[model samples]
Target chain A: AQSVTQLDSHVSVSEGTPVLLRCNYSSSYSPSLFWYVQHPNKGLQLLLKYTSAATLVKGINGFEAEFKKSETSFHLTKPSAHMSDAAEYFCVVILSGSARQLTFGSGTQLTVLP
Target chain B: GAGVSQSPRYKVAKRGQDVALRCDPISGHVSLFWYQQALGQGPEFLTYFQNEAQLDKSGLPSDRFFAERPEGSVSTLKIQRTQQEDSAVYLCASSNRDRGDHQPQHFGDGTRLSIL
Candidate 1:
C-alpha cells in the first residue's frame, strides 16, 4: 500500500515569486510519483511524474518537482508564479506492480496574489 | 482526438435514488481508474480496470458501489441506495499501458453527486 501527505492545505504566493508546495510519501518499494492540477469544476491535469528515471522532473506550465528518496519527499516548485497558477494541486503515488492504481494526497490550494 | 470525458458533470439525486456516472477515456487508452473525492479532500482510489478486467477494487466503499468498463473503452460507475454520505465528486482517469516509461494519466472533469 502507498500513501501520500501534503504538508500544507493552502499556499499563498505573489505573482512572479517563487512557489513551493510540499509533499511526502510512504511506499515499500520504488514508488512512482506524480503531480496534478485541477481548476474549479474542471478535470485534473497531469503536471509531471517521477519514475526512477530522473531525480528532478519538470512539468508543464513551468512547474517542476524533485524526488528525494531519503527524505521520502516530492516537493513541487516553480521559479516564477503566475496568476493562472492559482488552483488545487495534488501529489500522488503508485507502488510497484500495483496495476497503476494511485494514492492521492489531500491537495494544496495555491493562491496567487497579484 | 479527444481526452478523457465524464458525463453529467453535476447530478442531484434523492437520498434513496440511484445514479450512474459515465467515463470515456482517450483514444486507445487501455487502463482506466475511478476515484472518490470528498469535500476539501484528495481523491481516493475506488477501482481500476485494464481492458475490461477489474483487477483492483480494494478502495470501493461498499457493495452498493459498482463500476464496469465494458468493451474496454467507456466505463460507468453505478451507485445504489445513495445516501447523504455518498455526496461527492467522482473522478475518472485513463492511461496507456506503456512499459518502462512514465505513462501520464489523463483525467475527466468528474461528476459531482449531490444527494439530498
Candidate 2:
C-alpha cells in the first residue's frame, strides 16, 4: 500500500521565480522515489530518482529533490522556473518486494507565467 | 526505436467495440510495462512483463482487459467490449534491468483512447 500524496493540485509561478512542488510518501520500508514530468501530448519523462544513495538527489534541467526521512517528504525544487517547465508532474513510489509496481500521486499541474 | 514506441497515437471506438494498443519497448530491454492514465490524473500501473512472461497483472481493471508480449519485445494491450470508463491514455514503458532494480522506466507517447 505504498503511495504518494501531492500537496498541490495546481501551482502557478512567474518566470524566473523559484519552484516547489510538495510530495509526501507513505511506505513501510525505505522506498525508491521518482519524479516524472509530462508535457502536452508527450510521454512521461523521468526527472530524477532517489534510491537511498543520497538524501539530496539532483535531476535534469536544473531540477533536484531532497529525500527527508524525518519528514517523509521528497519535495521537488528548482532554483528558477522557465516557461518550458510548465507541465504535469507526478511523484511515484516503487512497490516494495518483487512486485516492482509504481504507485503514483494525483499529479500537480505546473503553470509558469512569463 | 530510440525510445519506447506506441502505435496509433489516437483511437476512437464505439462502446462495446474492441481495440488493441501496441507498445514496442527499447531494444534489448528485459522488462516492459503497461499503464492507464485518465484525464487530469496520474498514470496507474496496469500490468508488467518480464521477457514475454506476464509476471504481474494485478493492476488490470477487469477480465475485459488483456495484455501480451510474445518473444519478449513488442507488447499489446487489448480491451474487449470497451466502455466509456475505459477511455483513457494507455501508456507503455520499458526498462533495461531485472525486477527490483532501480533502473528508471522509459515511457512512450501514450495512445489516447476514446470510447463513445
Candidate 3:
C-alpha cells in the first residue's frame, strides 16, 4: 500500500515570505507524486507533479517541488508568498502497481498574513 | 466540456432518502474517478472507471453506495438511505488516459451533500 503524510497541519506566513510545506511518502515501488491546492469552496487544482522524469518540478503560480529519493520527501516551495496563495495543500502519491487510486496526505492549511 | 463537471453543486437530502450525484468528464477522457471528502479531511478515493467499464470500487464505504458509468462519458454516484454520516463533498475527476500512465487528473468543483 502507498500513503502520504504531510508534516504540518497548518502553516502561517507573512506576505512576501518564503513558503514551504513538507510531505513524506511510503510506497513499495516508484511513486508518482503530486501537489494540489484547494481554495475555499472550490475544487482542487493541480500545482505540480513528479513523474520519473525530473527531480525538480515547476508548477503553476510560481510553485515548485523537488523529489528527494533519499529523504523519501517531496516538499512544495515558493520563493515568495502571495496573499492569494492562502489555501489547503495536499500531497498525493500513486504507487506503480496499485489500482491507481491516489493516496492523499492529511493536508496543510496555509494562511497568509498581511 | 471545458473540464470535469459535477451537477447540483449542492444537495440536501432527508434521512432515509436516496440521492444521486452526476459527473461529466472532459470530452475524450478515458478514466473517471469519484472521491469523498469530509470536513477537515483529505479526499478519499471511492471508485474508478475506465471508459464504460467499472474497474475498481474498493473505496466505497458500503453496499448502499453505488456508482455507474455505463456510457463512460458521464458517471453517477447514488446513495441509498442517506444518513448524517453521508454528508460530505463528493468530487469527480477525469484523466486523459490510463491512470497507471501517470497523467494528471482534472477535478470538478464537487457536490456538497447534506443529509438532514
Candidate 4:
C-alpha cells in the first residue's frame, strides 16, 4: 500500500519568512507526487507535481518541491511567505498501477503572520 | 465549464436517508474519480471510472456506497442508508488522459454532506 505522511499539523511563519512543509511517502514502485493547496471552503488547487522527469518541480505562487527518491521525500518550500499563502497543504502520492488513485496526507495548515 | 463542477455544495440528510451527489468533469476528460474527505483529514479515494467504465471501486467502504458514470461525462455517487460516519465531503476529480500518462487531476469544490 502507498501512503503519504505530513510531518507538521500546523506551521506558523512571519511575512517574508521562509516556509517549509515536510512530507514523506511510502511506495512499492516509482510514484507520482503532487502538492495541493486549499483555502477555507474552497476546492483544492494543484501546486506542483513530480512525474519522474524533474527532481525539482516549481509550481504556481512561487512554490517548489524537490523529489528525493533515496529519501522517499517530497517536501514543499517557499522562499518568502505572504499573507495570502496561509492555507492548508496536502502531500499526495499516486502509486504506479493504482489506476490513477491519489493518496493524500493529513494536511498541514499554514498560518502567515503580518 | 472551465473546471470540474459538483452540485449541491451543501447537503443535509437524516440518518438512513439516501443521498446522491453529482459531478461534472472537465469536458473531454477520459478519467473521473470520487473521494471522501472526513473533517480534519485528507481525502481518500473511493472509486474511479474511465470513459463510462468503472475500472476500480475497491476503496468504497461498503455496498451502501455506489457511483456511476453513464456517458463518461457526468457522474453520480449515491449513498444508501447513510450513517453518521458517512457524513463527510464527497469530492470529484477528473484527468485529461488515462492512468499511465500521469496527468494531473483537477478537483471540484466538493459537496459537503452532513448526516443528522
Residues A78-107 of candidate 1: C-alpha lDDT, one tens digit per residue:
999999999999998875555667778999
- lDDT for position A7 in model 3: 99
Query: Per-residue lDDT of B30-114 in model 3, one digit per residue for the tens?
Result: 8998999999999999999999888899899999999999987999999999999999999999998866577888999999999
Q: What is the C-alpha interface RMSD of model 3?
A: 1.4
RMSD, candidate 2, Å: 0.8
> TM-scores for all candidates?
0.95, 0.98, 0.98, 0.97
Better of 2 and 4 by DockQ: 2
Q: What stretches of model 4 exceed 4 Å from their correct place? A: none
lDDT of 3 by residue, A1-114 (tens): 689999999999999999999999887777899999999989989999999799999999999999998999999999999999999999998755435877789999999999
Query: For all candidates listed, what's the TM-score of chain B alone?
Result: 0.95, 0.98, 0.98, 0.98
lDDT of 2 by residue, B4-89 (tens): 99999999999999999999999999999899999999999999999989999999999999999988999999999999999999
Clashes of 4: 0
Clashing pairs in 3: none
What RMSD does each model have against the real structure?
Answer: 1.6, 0.8, 1.0, 1.1
lDDT of each: 0.90, 0.95, 0.93, 0.93
Can you list each candidate's DockQ? 0.69, 0.82, 0.75, 0.76
Please say which candidate is ahead in lDDT: 1 or 4: 4
TM-score of chain A of each: 0.95, 0.97, 0.96, 0.96
Cα lDDT tens digits for candidate 1, B1-116: 48888999999999989999999999888889899999998888898888899888988999999999879889999999999999999999898883213687789999999999
Docking level of model 1: medium
Q: Write the per-residue lDDT of candidate 4 for residues B1-116, one digit (tens) a residue.
A: 89999998999999999999999999999999999999999999999999999999989999999999999899999999999999999999999887736688999999999999
Could you tell which candidate, 3 or 4, scores higher by TM-score?
3
**Which residue ranges in model 1 land beyond 4 Å of their true spot?**
B98-101
